[model samples]
Target: MSDQKPSPLSIGDFATWEPVLRLLWAGSEVHHAGRPARVAGRIGRRSWSLNLRTRLPSPGRAAQVEDIREEVDAVKRVRGALADAGVDDVSFTAEIQPSGEAVLRLLGPSPAVEPGIGTPYPGALILVDGSLPEPWRRLPDPVAGAVPAPSADLKLLERRLREGLPDAVGATEEEITAAEARLGITLPAELKVLYRVTRARWEDYNDDHEAAGRESAAVGCELFDLDALYIADASSRHCRWEFAAMEAVDTPPDAAVQGLVGSPGWIAFGDTGGGDRLAVDLTPGPRGHIGQVIMLSHEESIGAALVADSLTDLVLGRPSTRSSSARGQRPPATAWVTTASLKNVQAAAHPGLEALSIGVWDSAPLSLAPFTGLPRLRTLTAYPGTLADPLEITELPGLEFLQLGPQEWRVLLDARAVPRSLSAAAIVVHGNQDPLPVVALANEILALWDRPRIVQTVLEGAVGPGPGAQPGADRRSGGTPQ
Candidate 1:
């Protein structure tokens, strides 16, 4: 065996004409020696494309035209393969150089390609680079199937701090204060720094970054040492902080708590792990008080129970205290409910709730009457299914948004009912009852309302005339015109 290694090939190697000379010498068989080809260009903020080329056999002049046609078909196959692999925004164009030579260019981002090493006489070789172009920005949010973002509540932080600080030194407040007065020295600056930061604006830290910031602050100040005076100051500040013990108590299950006049409120519920249930309490005050309660319980049923219980405490004023943060304390009047079963719509537990979304656990008929009495209900959504009864949706004077899939569309059409209060609606039809009548019905409706924008007509067969029929024959009746 020869004691020599092959030279490495980069992406630029294939761009040259020398590769063509080498392949011609090796019986016109060219094999890709580098990564698969890709388009490395961008079109707009979130759009990108790739570039690729391949060689074709130099058959004699008689078959040269056929050879080019076959290569074009091969390029189409490649495009189809990329599309099947979930790649999008693709295009193809080719350039034929002098001397019966050709370059096929494919446009798209880093698309998927198979890996192999083989030689075919008078065949093309592809080279690819996987790097994205400059000015490429990160995706604003994680991909749908990727990991989820971290969620947290700041009120929980304050509550945990208040509960943990009192027992840190195991001494009475007077004793602690007397000792601090006699020491003639202020406690560590770190504790005071944290207390001030947490008190100033806890909402500023209310996100995935909260735990990270807290950890950094604690470690920087060396607060873990039991003998340190930092813990003493934190405890002292806790005893004096006005809202330190402002526990979020239960309220009536159906009480309308005012929120900021123009601010948006959101409510979400489902089984997110841990024993904690998420309850958002928005109360109206000088500004706004948005308190979130995390009730810990391993069972989902228990979590819902805790949410119901907390709402009762919050509404009844059983455990009431104002927050020192001037943002105010008020109950959220608008609640959006997402549940595993539509039956749990009542679990919203908010009286005079303004908005609602009911996500079904499975395909089942939904009854709109049960929810019709809602005084403030504005929006309602459910999975695709038949309606239990003929419902005049217009009865709900406040209804605004309604979404229905194919099955629900059939139900509404069969009942001969139209939603008069609907300002916006989406109707999805799965299959045609009969293509011709459906088309005619759509055309009739469009003509009646003089609204061409709402109807889209797609005809499947030939446009001009039927097979083996005269130009003016009536295809539907199989007869010549009168």
Candidate 2:
């Protein structure tokens, strides 16, 4: 299929180039891998479908049920992303076509009739009469003498990171500058250092030095290489074009359809091998942490997974990304992981202070004053407590959520001060406590909060016999279970 003219279409190119193709004519992905796979009947009203072959290396690969299933899974993920990206009804279908190539299908709005350029192929789009409308090659060149050199901080970081590499992974300032010009934007400062240091995966860095599958490195540092496309041509196609499409398909539910800013303005810079991406956020989310790194996973319930605000933080024990040294063992580097036992965290010397949660009896006192150094601490949840206190969490600078003993939180409501950063609080309300008191307290908490915040009561214990049953209660309706 690689040698075929017009060739078998790719799932990505079919989506991108077909819009350009629609300028001249209305077309749809009809079939693929020796069978009919039309999504017109199944697609939602606001969406379209693209059908083409799987982008596998070999021809007729989709004829195998395994390959077909792979493409189907890929399409489902892409559709879910589009839904989150605020693109309504952006779904797709695929099948093995009669020609033995997989056919990819996408269903969206009908293409507009505006004059357009660019073929489904790599080159610039052109008029039917052979006049150029858009480049078939790379983006237009940047004007001379206007491009900015790499920042000093970027250079210093690069120098510290570039140890042992003689040629510095073959990236040059000229290449990065050209890429910025083509994309019409400068990279974030740390990203500039990142690309300059290396564009290859750190795992693959020792491929040349591997002696019969053994691993070795000259440096003892725990830092891993970040993914970068330092070259202009790769960035334009992979970063600029393909990254936009990937983000569009994975738009967060809160974003607007017309003015969609995907996953809080994050752009893909590295891949996590599990279809998740590491990105640099251009538009800060409600957290107001700008230029921070985030993980975008189609599999994630909330699409954005906060990694770190900077690269240096990732390498240290602060906001460490998944590392062989830390992962699958004990306490994770940051607040991102969940563990069954707090003892494991203490044994690992990880503090487990950031976003800590534990099942503690209400009488047990949790002191925030002991961990005063952990400024990143944001959430604290303890349950089945007899009392709670706002003073326990008053000093946490980043505390956004607190769940503690009911008595403590109630007393906290009456306390002279509450943490300004405390945006949400959850507390256990024993059945013996009247609903009116806690309900009124919830209202007072909401009224006291200047911004939107949540106050929730987790009910426990039985009020004699339940309405429908004698013992436990249904979680949803708050009624007794049969």
Candidate 3:
């Protein structure tokens, strides 16, 4: 009988999980009908169902390739979740279609859901907070609806932008043609996708890092619009025109920059609200290393900083750190980890240590004590099964945000030693049909969150498929807690 007061979970991670779910549902929602499932402890068989109801376009509206990819990705996530749970006898069937009733049924030795709302079943839920609620569920942004999104071609590219972006729309074939005709140089396919399919502002909101509103991301960096794209020469792309108009700046050594590459012929497209922009190196094909995306900023001495080698890296976002035992580059701000061995991480800890994500998996327990060495770990994501000791969190004093996996969070909360200075927390729940316990936990967290300093909290998971209060915004941004 351990009757100790529980500490709170930390919800301060920067990357989010909305992209997967958004891509999956397209424009549908689940409507639960039966009594919710009961919470089973760390034992017994587990079953869950995702009963999704989608609204097909009225009349002649059509589905696109991104929709198909989203559907497939949804199935992959389901299967991956089951396998990650380490279930011995896993069996489930999914009939997710373009129309009609769509269900994701699972039976496992155990598994993941949407948060706060409760799990669609009695197992785990794989959802995250901090993102604007599904765009379709909220009121349309005044300007978001006004943005032009002409799409006659690039169905796959269009779908991707729509799934992940707030007000994504694609460029017409004519628009793409006109830009290339004006630039004179043949635009790379990936570069065309970057500017044509969506608004490429890549604006970095320096003053408003905490601005989490749906449309706030557009306020900063000046991405090249189609009209700008047509007129700009090699010397003055996007923000470069402004920079080029100024004076000559000193350059730094290559190793210091976060997202730049070698040579000086790169064409700038997007930028940080300040002096840096994401560029494509024209020096590649000539130098036998073409098509790489790097960072070029006037603020720092570092020039040609390497970002990801290609556009695919934007989605996967991994630095080529050579092979095992060698230190790969760390992201300047965040590192999204899906798979990596302990040794690989140990060697790769020097660069981007601000925000790190260790993707959830049902693997053997590992110690977090070692990661305390990550000097700049402001935010860290933890899986319950991965930690051998929850108290290892106490060693770090600078930690600001803590993201916790289901049962493991209970252990941390039970220990009651979470640093009061920790500003935010994210908790993933293994949902059961019963809503009372889940609601009680969220309520309790909300009540106590006002202490030490009001903590930013995000509650999401498949808690209940039906209607419920969704945590509104990341508290750090001054949004009210739901």
Best-fitting candidate, scored by TM-score: 3
Model 3: lDDT equals 0.40
Report the C-alpha displacement of residue 365, candidate 3, in angstroms: 1.3
What TM-scores do the predictions have?
Answer: 0.28, 0.29, 0.33
Superior by lDDT: candidate 1 or candidate 3: 3
Question: Which runs of model 2 end up more than 4 angstroms from their true locations?
Answer: 1-156, 164-167, 201-265, 300-303, 320-482
Q: Output the lDDT of residue 428, model 3.
A: 47
lDDT of 2 at 167: 42
Query: Candidate 2, residues 126-200: lDDT per residue as tens digits?
Result: 112221111122132222232212222454455555654444463478877875775556777777666666544
Scored by lDDT, the top model is 3
Candidate 3 per-residue C-alpha lDDT over 1-482 given as tens digits, one digit per residue, 9 for 90 to 100: 98633222221211122223333334333312222222211111233223333446557768654545654454444444434444323322222233222232222221121222213222222122222111111121111112111221245544454455545454677877887676666666666766554644334333443432322243223456565643112223222111121112112222222122223335566565577666655543211234455665565422345555554344333443411111234333444444554333454355335655566555655566556756666666665465667788787666655656556666666777655645445554442233333433443343444421112233233211223422222222231322
Give the C-alpha lDDT of model 2.
0.38
Expressed as tens digits, the lDDT of each residue in 398-423 for candidate 1 is: 75445444455455556656454433
The C-alpha RMSD in Å for every predicted model, in order, reads 22.7, 22.3, 20.9
